[model samples]
Each structure stands twice: as C-alpha cells, then as structure tokens.
Target chain A: MTRLRFAPIPAGLPATVPFTGPETLERRRGVPFVARLGANENGFGPSPKAVEAMARACAEAWKYGDPDNHDLREALAAHHRVAPENIMVGEGIDGLLGVLVRLTVAQGDVVVTSDGAYPTFNFHVAGFGGLLHKVPYRDDAEDPQALTAAARDVGARLVYLANPDNPMGSWHSGALIEAALDELSADSLLVLDEAYAEFAPDDAIPQIDPEDDRVIRFRTFSKAYGLAGARIGYAIGPAKLIAGFDRIRNHFGVNRTAQIGALAALQDNDWLEQTRRNVGAARERISAIAQDNGLTALPSATNFVTIDCGANGDFARKVLAGLSDLGIFARMPGTAPMDRCIRISCGPEAEMAAFAEALPIALAKAREV
Target chain B: MTRLRFAPIPAGLPATVPFTGPETLERRRGVPFVARLGANENGFGPSPKAVEAMARACAEAWKYGDPDNHDLREALAAHHRVAPENIMVGEGIDGLLGVLVRLTVAQGDVVVTSDGAYPTFNFHVAGFGGLLHKVPYRDDAEDPQALTAAARDVGARLVYLANPDNPMGSWHSGALIEAALDELSADSLLVLDEAYAEFAPDDAIPQIDPEDDRVIRFRTFSKAYGLAGARIGYAIGPAKLIAGFDRIRNHFGVNRTAQIGALAALQDNDWLEQTRRNVGAARERISAIAQDNGLTALPSATNFVTIDCGANGDFARKVLAGLSDLGIFARMPGTAPMDRCIRISCGPEAEMAAFAEALPIALAKAREV
Candidate 1:
C-alpha cells in the first residue's frame, strides 16, 4: 500500500501538547480537580453581560460569523485608540501566534525567545521548521535584552517577549520594552505577547504606535476578559504588517458567540475593574499562603502567583505532584531556576480556600519525599 | 523606520477575502438583507437543545476548552463508528482544510480540484504555495474522473472533491466516487469534503473505512445541523495522517461552547431529520420559484438550490444585483459556465415567500439589462 506523505516539517515534529491541559489530567485521574488554579485561566468568569450576550448569540448560531470581524475590530480599535486596519481579530492569541509564525518563519528560519517562556510559541516556530535560539531569563523575567541580542546575532526572523510573563508571573516596565525595541533588528519582528497585560500595571505596557511595523502585539479576551473558552484575541500592528495576516489567517475562525461575548465584555468596564481587584486580592492571598508554607512567592503583576519552593527543581516538581495528588491543579515552569517555582492562577474565594487548605499537606508530602 | 520581513509565500500573496461575507455586503449597502439566502447556512437554525447547551457552556466560559478535544472527538468517533484516533476536530471545515493543506502541500506542490470549486481551498493551497489544477465541471457536477486524471497528470499531492458540491449544488452517487478512487493516483491524498452529507442521499456518500489512508473526509455542524456560527468541524482519516495534525493544530482552537453546542446538536437526531425534511420542502419551493421566473432549478442534494438564469453569466449577475437591491442576499459561482446560475439557500416560509415575491422583479430587471 502506498503511504501518504506529510511535509518534512510536520512529519519530523514530535507529537506534543505544548502545555498539558487540566482537563486531560482530570480524565487520566478519573476525577475533577478541586481548585483549578492552573493554565492561568481567569476563574472569576466573564462579565455577566458577556455571558448574556453569548446566550443571545446562541439563538443565531446558524449564520456563519462575519468573516471580516468588522464590528469587533472596530470596537477594539476604538478601545485601543487605533485604526481598525491596525487590528486583526483571531481565534485567540495562540491561534494568532500560529499564523504569525507561519507568515514569517520558513524552513530553517531563526527565531529567538527566552528559555522556558511560552512553550506554545516555541511549538509554532518549530512546527514551521524555524530554528529557535533560547536566551536565559534575567532574574526570572523574560530578558528582552537577551532576546534582542540573540535575534541580532542569529539574524532571526522573529523574537518573542511576554510582558508580565507567564509561569514566573514577572514583568518588565514599558520603558524597558521601548528601549528593547530600539535594539531589535530592523529585519526582525518582535512578537510582544501581552496576554496578561490586562492584569499588569499600566506602565508595563509600552505606548507603541499601532503602526509600528517592527513590532506586533497580541492581546486576548481569554485572559482578564475571562473568555478563554471563547477563543477570541487580536493582534495590533502596522496596517501593512497586519494585512499580511489576511493572506493566511482563518478569517472566520472567531465564532459568532465569541464576537458577541467579547464585545459585551469590552463594554463592561465595571466588571473588568472588579475582576482586576479580585485578581489582586487573590494574588496577595496566594502569596500569604506560600509564606505560610515557608515558600517565597514571586512578586506578580499578572493574575497568577509563582511561588518559589526555596528548593531545587526536583523539590518543586515534588510539590507540584503533591498538589496534583491533593486535587489542586497548579503548574510549574519548564526549566530551572524557574522550575524551582510553581505557578497558581487566581480564582473564586472558594477555590482559593481549597488551595489554602491543600498547600500545607502538599508541602509536607514534598518535604517527606 | 525599520521594516519587518515576512516569509516570501505570504508576502507575495494577494490580500483578498476568498468569499465576500453577507455582513460585508450589508455594511456596504447600509442595510441588512431581508432574506439571507446566499451563504448556504441553515436558516431553520440549530437544534434548540444545542442553543441551550451553548448558553449553559457560556457560564463556564472562563475555563479554557480541553486542548485535546477529548470528549467531543470521542463522541464523534462513536457517532461515526470510528476510533477517536482517526478524528481531529477543528475551528471549522475551513480551518481544517487550511491545516491539512499546510501539512501536505509544500511550496510548488500540485493540488487538483474542480474548477470554481471551493475557492477557500484554492486560497489555502495558494497561500501555502501549492499549484492548483482546476477541472471543469461535468454537467454541473464535479467530475471525479477528471479530478483524478488531473491529479495523476500533475503528480498532485492533494485532490479536493466536494461531494454534493457547493455553488452548483450538484452531487454524484457513492458508487461513482468509490469507482473514481481507483483512477486516483496512489501517491495523492483525496480531500473528500462532505459538508453537505447530512442533506445528501445515502448513495451519495461512499462507505469508506475510517482507516483509509488515501482519503480524508471533512464534515461539519454548519449545514443541516445549523451550527455554523459555532465554528466546529472534524476530519476523519487514518490515525497516522490524523496524528500529523497534532504537530501543527491550535490544540485549544475549538471553542468550549462550540464543542458543547455541536455535541448537543449531534445527539438531537430528531431535529436533524426534521431539518432534512424542511430542506427538501424548501428545495422544491425554490424550484417552483425558479419555474415561475422561467428559469431552470438544478436538482440539489444540499440545502441550497442553484437556478440557471436562462441567460449568460452577465444576465445572472444582473439578476443577483437586482435581488440584492430587493434586499435578498444571493450568490453565484465565480467561474465561467457555472456563473450562468445563481444560488439561494434554504430558509423559513417567510423568507421563501420573500424570495417568491422578489424573483419576478429580479428576472424582469435581468431581462431589461
């Protein structure tokens, strides 16, 4: 029998999930997690208005979503004070990253990202046959300077930096990012991922011009907007650069309900402000819980708190395993010394209470191990 | 200011929408179409149960969807009597097609399809640098033999055939497709798009083993199931070929509500059967409407009817324009001989009555033109 042939890039790729989903773990263990504090998902949930909008949209589920994403993009543009042409809505930040990588990285192209940063970005780069150059994080923050240097040295096509970074929950100021942009190679594109920007301090986001051709920024409704399951996000960049996405993006990838829900979510500023306060309070509580367990929690500007186990990667892994065993779903960084920390997402008071209750036992188990 | 460099393939491709959405036209005209009968969407709407499921899922929208799509894939596998490994769910059939093309079609790779067949498929192939070979329709139906012959001659990597073809709404017997498989080159993969299979006769869909490596079949909830706005679809193929998708698919691309909505839609077979009956009745009514205008309505195995305008492509364009002026959204094939007809989708009695009232005026306008 003749065998089907896949392109060399995909054929050689290891079948891997960039991040293990909480649901997958539950299915494997045959039990639901007690506190779903992993995956950095917003647990306070979408604005009540967004939920109502989704319910309303469900009635019109027969019509395919507007392929142009006109209304959503227009609304986003108004919110951002940018031209609609500067925004391209997509399935989510992950989906946008995939398309961005496909649009820039050809076989044997070079890409730069901090070591153990967003693994999904690496997955996309590798899927398109781009060679990745890893720059070690500088003091647990995504070292934008090192990333820029690596891009310049390798003549990389793309460089990735996540502000208010994931796993570590550390952030860089807007001034630092603007300075890093000056150092970014003209030929290279800086993929500034601001998925967690909504949770970050205002100064953490650089006031870059929407038409900055050298940089593309991704923001998502999945994060602070609390619509991760809706799979809605957008890239803000120069008109010419943004137009490149139209050449290859799944135009109608954003669902109708997602569009409606996100629009409603954007309109509900009071709910967003309330969720931000909730996340801030939750983060403090998580830090306090970590301190109680004799762990040092990293200062976080995002929704999640990354707690240092005050031990090695192995010890941290043990603690994470113990937490899993205790039915609390939390995650850790992929590489050291970041791997010495376990990340926990903010959630409702009950979930936080569950985490608070489980932490001590998980720590004791890790210590015994 | 420094400019960023894009991959040659995307940079060279034109920024064009493969199809102009109805919303775009509405925006352009500054008014919504009175009867949306253009995009082949099920105007009868999704099963009420699916809408309820979506509304329910909206409450839990903060959680990211299961990246593996485990439950839905498992359910779909059971529904198809295939193993879960043989199935891959995606944002939509359009999304799946984009990925499948990316997986197999490298730059300059040859792909064969019927002329004026699914422009989005051609758009994807071109976006990925695949050379497209178009075979003219044989008697308004996609000529499977011609497609196979073209694939063989071009050493194509992929061949696309939409059974119960779109735009023209023509179809072939399942035995014919099975026989045409013999004519297909051993090395080429057949992309069997059965988006309308739910509306087709039994003989129109061949009973191929799910493990068949030479072919991959795509089905969607967008048609008779009436969940197009949910943006969910799946591809069935051999496990090996299906696994290739894992290397590049946006793991959590399928929205949580979409997964819930589609699953609920699938379980409501009564709604589907009723939808089929409604579509059949609508098709007959459309044919009568065409007869009233002294035009010929092509027999359709799908939810839409393609009516020959009883004149040339120019005349059909005028008729379509007149319909648009009369606030009825309709579309026609983009390429030659096929463009001589206009396509209208199935809708409720009110929409059908609107079409009936408007057809004669549109025809008169076309005659005057």
Candidate 2:
C-alpha cells in the first residue's frame, strides 16, 4: 500500500506536544489532581461580567464570528492606544506564533532563543523548518542580551524572549529589555511573549511602540484575565508585520464566544485588579511555604513561583512525580540546572493548602530516592 | 530604515480574506443585516443542552482545554463506531484545512480542486505556495471524475472535494464517490470535506473504513449542529494521517467551552434530528420562494438552497447587491456559470419571511441595474 507523503519538514519532525496537559496526566493516573497548577492558568477565573456575557452569547453560537474581529480589535486598540491595524487577534499566543513563524521563517532559516524557554515557539520554528540556535540562560532568567547577540551572530530571522520568564519565574526590568532591543540586529525580529504581562510588575513590562518594526509583542487573556480556555490573544507590532499575518492566518479561526468574553474581560478592570491582588497574596504564601519546607523560592514577577529544590534535576523529578502521586499537579523546567527547581502556579487558598500539605511528603520521598 | 522581510510565499501573496464576513459588510453599511442567510450557518442553533453546557463551562474558562481533546474524540469515535485514534479534533474545518495543507504541501506542489470550491482551502494552498489545478464544475456540481483525472495528470499531492457541495447545494451518491475513489491516484490524498454531512442524505456520506489512507473526511459542528461561532470540528481518517496532526497542530488551540459544547451537542441526537427536519422544511420554503420570483432553486441535500437568478453572473451579483440593500445577507459563487446562482442559508420563519419579502424587490432592482 502506498503511504501518504508528508512535506519534508513535518515528515522529519517527531509527533510531540510541547507540554503535557494536566488532563492527560489525570487520565493516565485515573484520578483528577486535587490542585491544578501545572499549566500557569489563573485559578481565580474570569470576571462575572465576562462569564455572563459568554453565557448570553451562547444562543448566538450558530453565527460565525466576525472574521475581521473588528469590535475586539477596536477595543484592544483603544486599550493599548494603538491603531487597530497594529493589533491582530488570534487563537492565543501559540496560534499567533505559528502564523508569525510561517510568515517569516522559511526553510532552514536561522532563529534564536534562550535554552529552556517556551517549547511551543520552538516547536513552531522547527515545524516551519527554521534552524534554532539556543543560548544558555543567564542566572535563571532569559538573557535578552545573549539572545540579541546570538541573533546578530546567526543572522536570525526571529528571536523569542518571554518576559517574566516561565519555569524559572524570573524577569528583567523594562529598561533592560529596551536596552537589549537597541542591540538587536536590524534584520532580526524580536518575538516578545508577554502572556503573563498582567501578572508582572508595571516596570517589568516594556513600553509599546506600535511603529517599531523589529519587535512583535504578544499578550493573552489566558493568564491574568482568566480565560485560558477561551483561546484568545493578540500581537502588537508594526502594521506591516501585523498585515503579513492576514496573508496566511485562518481569518475566522477566532471563536466568537472567546472574542466576546475577552472584550468583556478587558472592560472589567476591577476584576483584573482584584485578581492581581489575589495572585500577589498567593505568591507570598507560596514563598513562605517554600521557606517553611527549607527550599528557596525565586523572586518572581509572574503568577507562578519556582522553588529551588536544594538538589539536582533527578531529585526535582522525583519531587514532581511524588507530588503527582499525592494529587498535586506541578511542573518543572525541562533542561538541566534550571530543572533543579519545580514550578508551581498560584491558586486560591484551597489549592495552596493542598500544595503545602504535599510538599514535605514529596520532598521526603525524593530524599529517599 | 530596513524593512522587515517576510518569507517568499507570504511576501508574494496578497493580504486578503477568503470570504468577506457579513459583519464587515454591516460595518461598512452602518446597518445590521435583517436576514443572515449567508455563510450557511445553522440558524436553528445548537442544542439547548449544549448551550447550557457552554454556559456552565464558562466559569472554568481559566483552564486550558485538554490539548489531547480526549473525551470529545472518544465520544466522536463511539458515535461513528470507529476507534478514537481515527479522529482528530481541531478549532474548525478551516483550521484543520490549514494544518493539513501545511503538512502535505510544499512550495510548488500540485493540488487539485473545483474552480469555485471553498475559497479558504484555496487560500491555504496559495499561502503554502502550492500550484493549484482547478477543474471546472460539471452541471453545477463538483466533477469528481474530472478532479481525479486532473490529479493523475498533475501528480497532485492533494485533491479537495466538498461533498453536498457548497454554493450549488449538489451532491453525488456515496456509491459514486466510492467508485471515483477507485480512479484516484495512489499518490494523491483526497480531502473530502463533509462539513454539511448532518444535512446531507445518509447515502451522500460514504461509509467510513477508518483504514483508507487515500481519503480523509472532515466534519463540523458549524453547520447542522449550529455551533459555527464555537469553532469546533473533527477529521476522521487513517491513524497515520490523524497522528500526523499532533506533530504540527496547536495542541491547546481548541477553546475549552467549544470542546464541552461540542460534546454536549454530539450527545443530543434528538436535537440534530429536529434540526435536520427544520432544514428540510426551510429548503422547501426557499425553493417555493424561488419559484414565486420566477427563479429556479437547485435540488439540495444540505441546509442551503442555491437559487439560479435566471441570468448571467452580472445579474446574480446585482441581485445580491439589491438583497444587501434590503438588509438581507446572501452570497453567490465567485466563478462563471456557477456565479449565476445565489446561495441562501436555512433560517427560522422570521428570517425566511424577511428573505421571502425581499426577493422580488431585489429581483426588480437587479433588473433595473
């Protein structure tokens, strides 16, 4: 029998998901996690107003969403103080990143990123046949300077940097990122992912200049806005770069309920502020718990906290597995050195309590191993 | 200033939407559409149970949908009497098409489709730099034999066929499609888009072997299931082709509420039966309306009727403009011969009455033009 032929890129690629979702673990284990914190999802949930709006819009689900995403784009533009053309809404940062890579990264093109950064971006770069050059992280944070230098050295078409970086939960200030941007090669485009921007301190977020052609920043409702399941995010960049997305993106791909709910979520500033306060409290409590367990928690600008396990990667792996066995879902970085720390998302009191109760037991088991 | 460079494919392609959504038209005209009979969306709406499920799921929106889409795929598998491995759920058929094209089509690859078939598929092919070979429709229907012949001639990597064809509302028998499958080149994979399958006669949908490597069929909740805005769909094919999607798809792309709603919608078989009946009645009513206006409605096995304007493409276009002027939203085919027909979606009595009342006026205005 003749086999279906795949393009060389996909044919060479291994079938893998960037992250193993919590549900997959639950299914494999035959039991649901008592505390769900693995994926950096907001535990506080979306605003009541957004929830109400989505519920109300349920009956109208028969109509296709505006392929243009006009209202949402307009709202986002007003919120960000940019022209509507500078903003392109899509099915989350992951989806938008796929389109961006498709637009810029031709086969065997060079791209640069810090080691152990977002795997989905790397997956997209590989899927598009881009050759990725990875620079080591400096002090457990994404080294923007190293990334920019590598881009210059490799003639990189794209460079990815996650602000308030994931896994390690460390961040660089806005001034530092701006300085790094000045050093970026003119030919290299910076892919700034700010999925956790709402959780980051104000100084941690760089000022938006929509006219800048060398950088595209992504923001999402999945984290601070509590709409991860909605799958809505936007990229802010030069109009020309933004326009390039329309040439290849699925125009009607944004779910209508997601668009409407995101709009409502955007409008509810009080809810956002309250959620921020809740996250701040949870972060402090998590740090205190880490200290109580004789572990050091890294300073974080994002919603999650990464704890140094006071041991090696194997010990941390054992700790993570033990936590899963104890019905607490958490994750750690995938690479060495950084993998010595386990990452846990901030949630409400109950989830925090679950984590606190399980940590010592998991650590004990890891020590036994 | 150096300009940001796009890869050659997108650089050469025009930034255009395949279909101009009705919302775009409404924004331009500053008037809401009174009858949305365009886009072939199911006006009867999703099951109330599905709507309620979505509404309930809105609170849990902070969690990412299971990237595996395990439960829904399992349900779809059971419903179809196939194994879960045969099904791959995605954002929509539009999204799945984009992924499929990316996986199969490389630069300058050959693809075959009917001249006036779904433009989104064509857009994807062009976006991927595929050389498309278009075969003309025969008797207002997609010519399967011609498509297979063209595929063989061109050594096409992909051949696209929309069963219960769009715009013309025509279909071939399952037996006929099975027969045509015999003639399809071994090297070519058939993309059988059965998005309108629920409304199609049972025989119009071919029996699923789940082992056939030459064909992959796409079905959607967007049409008869009435969840177009929710943007959920699935493809059933050989496990190898189905597994290939995991290598490149956005694992977390499917919205959580959409997955939940689709599952609920699938379980409500009674609602689907009612919707089919409603569509059957609407088809009759639309044909009757066409006769009243001295137009001819093509025989339909789907949720829409394609009305022959009894003139050329120009006349049909003018009639479409007239309908737009009367606050009725309708669409027509984009190519010659097929372009002489205007397609209308089935809706409730209110929208139907609006279209019924506007047809003659639109016809008169069209004649004036």
Q: Chain A TM-score per candidate?
A: 0.99, 0.99
Best by lDDT: 2
How is the predicted docking of candidate 2 categorized under the CAPRI scheme? medium
lDDT of 1 by residue, A1-369 (tens): 354778778888898869888989998889999989988899999999999999988989999999889999999999999999999999999999999998888889899999999999999999989999999998999998888988999998899999989989999999999999999887888999999999999999998999877799999999899999999999999998888898999887889999999999999999999999999999999999999888899999999999999989999899889899889999999898899999999998998999999989988998996
* TM-scores for every candidate against the unseen true structure: 0.99, 0.99
Off by over 4 Å in 2: A1-3, B1-3
Q: After superposition, how far is residue B323 of candidate 2 from its true place, in Å?
A: 0.4
The DockQ of predicted model 2 stands at 0.79
Q: Which ten residues in a row have the lowest lDDT in candidate 2 chain A?
A: A1-10
Question: What Cα-based lDDT does every candidate model obtain?
Answer: 0.92, 0.93
lDDT of 1 by residue, B1-369 (tens): 335557889878888878888999999999999999999999999999999999989989998888888988999999999999999999999999999999998788899998889999998999989998889998998999989998989998999999999988999999998888878888899999999999999989998999877799999999989999999999999998998898899998999999999999999999999999999999999999999878899999999999999778999999999999999999999888999999999999999999999989988987885
Which TM-score value belongs to model 1?
A: 0.99
What lDDT does candidate 1 reach at residue A159? 92
Among the numbered candidates, top DockQ falls to: 2
